[model samples]
Target: MLRRSRCRWVFVCILLTVLLRLAPLKSDSDPTTQLIGDVDNTQSFGVNPISLILVQKLGYQSACNSCSHRDLGFTGRVAGKWYSVWADTLWAAPGVTDPELDTPGFHGMVRSSVSLLTDDPLRVVDLNLNDDWPVPHQQPFIPFNEDWGESSRTAFGGASLCEVDAGSATAAVFILVNAFEPDLVGAGVAKVQVINGTPTVTQRFGPKGYWWDATTTPHYGDKISYRDERSDYIYIWGGPPNRYTGWLEGGYIYLVRVKAADVFDLCKYEYWWGHQQGWKPEVLTTFTTETAALWGTGQGQIVWNDYYDCYILVHLGIAGVTLYMRTAKSLEGPWTPDLEIYSTTPIDGGLVYAGVAHPYLDPSGKSLVVSFTNNNRIEVVKVWFK
Candidate 1:
């Protein structure tokens, strides 16, 4: 009888061990609980629970001429307040003739500006543009001039902002400029300083061609950078080649990184060379690409989520008609297959692009505040990750 009892006790211990191994890991601050109260067991995507909720639509009441229509840009925290820059256009209004369109000396006159978002009354303060700042009525932010040649007469917009410590008295604000020109589209880098609670440009660096632009590198500047506190490095993620010209067709994602302090130096950047070898110092080196296409058009945002402990990328996919989400454990990732989070075809008949994620706006960390341009209007939505 004693031998039988001992054997039963050992079996019970084994059963408990197996049960603990099978149980899903849970944390007190798990975002899954905050975003989705209860998840459906029968739902697809295995254990990945994701959902999008349209929290609220934000609009700006601007007095600038032809500035009523705007599209989402990057947002960053500055001086204890959240600031966002957006692409402002006047062509969206009826009877507005944009002379810059198709004019040889003139490229499309789409410019950008900054705004202060206040939560108390939920209003956007259109900060008065500095004399040097680019406005549709004035000059381009990163001006495309006679030096750039006739093919490159365009302004910068759809920019992403990141604050870097240049070891100066004030933190430097870096703006990744996306330039839209005829025939050739590319990205440039610009630096701005916050003077008296306003953002102003201090330096500008390229509508510089992509690393692989010689052979028609389709999409260039969908590159998004975030300072990874854990690694003390600035992680930059770029998009795959475009189907345009069929040079390097397919939606592929690429990644690169630089020290947070060396963000201003392009030479210091390192590319994710491959899985086996890992990050390569050469920026031009070809690397292991994302297995699946993240977006049809390469314009979106990739943000690090502290709560989820994963990187979330939001982009306009499905031939530029839908907003999709993909998550990964690392920036140079074996990213999960693209999941359709929202469709924009119904929202203004598919005149949308640049779906960017703003984590600062959402405190819960479970819901992401995303903004996209629909018919020249910047539309905001909240995506809840279950």
Candidate 2:
């Protein structure tokens, strides 16, 4: 009887241990209860010190009489040997005064490159598609077919570019935020590839009545992407419909991912359905009963911080006056609550928005080159997180 009792106790303890290991981790603060079950399930707590300094407002001194632009949102990416940025809502006229804000001939987007030299990293120059670098000129490169229905009649508000592989490869996946187009009412994807000796762009519009199935509605505005070395997959994070889109729904965000090689294949997409369901082949549609959010909603970018040994998210407030930061152990995370990092008064007649962190600009990850739109121009700052 004594031996039997001991054996029974041992069996019960073993069962309990297995159950605890299988249960999902929960957080009181994170509404989604982010389930980090993979190998990189590490968490960091407490406050991390961060500092922000005004680097310089990026200026464009253009001689191209056909280079007028809009309230620009700067989303930078490392394409080939250069840092390329998607400059949204461009016009071919000499200049666009405030009266021309609603002008009709606004081409959707253009590509610009920032000089990657250590001397001046914020210099915006024209992109040389042949060599895949920035030249000493200010004329932006129009790499897409503006006459196409997908590229025409649309103005982008935000963009995130994920290079398929690190290095001189010119192939990448671009996610863009469509601003107030009656037909293209949300986000879209563009596959950028260098064919033969020139660059070529192929794009697909996002959830809309005419373009794609409107059931799977995911707002790519303020969206960001990161390549996980462990999983060898690039994760795209996006959320809460832009209130400007006339979307009065709840503010929630989700994540989707695809292998680097399969980025251009929409059929290979996988949606994050939390710990129980894990990743599903089907997307998170509008009517899905269960929804998950990636640390709430805001316009920002996520970068891995060597100092914090975690992922850091630097984003702007809804009003765009204050900038905030959040830290998480993993990409799919129980992220820390918003910690106000910087706040400043907006310039006269200018609102601050479209803030994102450029990691390639600061290779050491000690300081970040952050950019945002202020006074209808893109301004940059240096952010330090110790």
lDDT of each: 0.52, 0.51
Number of the top TM-score candidate? 1
Q: What local lDDT does model 2 show for residue 339? A: 70
Best by lDDT: 1
Model 1 misplaced stretches (Cα beyond 4 Å): 1-47, 51-67, 91-110, 120-122, 128-140, 145-147, 150-152, 166-182, 206-220, 240-244, 247-250, 285-297, 346-350
TM-score of 1: 0.66
TM-score for candidate 2, please give it: 0.65
Write the residue-wise lDDT of candidate 2 on 1-386 in tens digits: 99999999999999988765545456534322232233221232456545444334344223121233434333434444434344553433333423234366643344432222222444543333232122122333333344444453344433455667545444444444343454335554555554442334444433331222222456543356665545667787666433313221233556777887787677887877764467888866531213454533456677777766778877774546777777777676667767766565676756766566666666677777666655545556666654
Cα RMSD (angstroms) for every candidate in the order listed: 13.2, 11.1
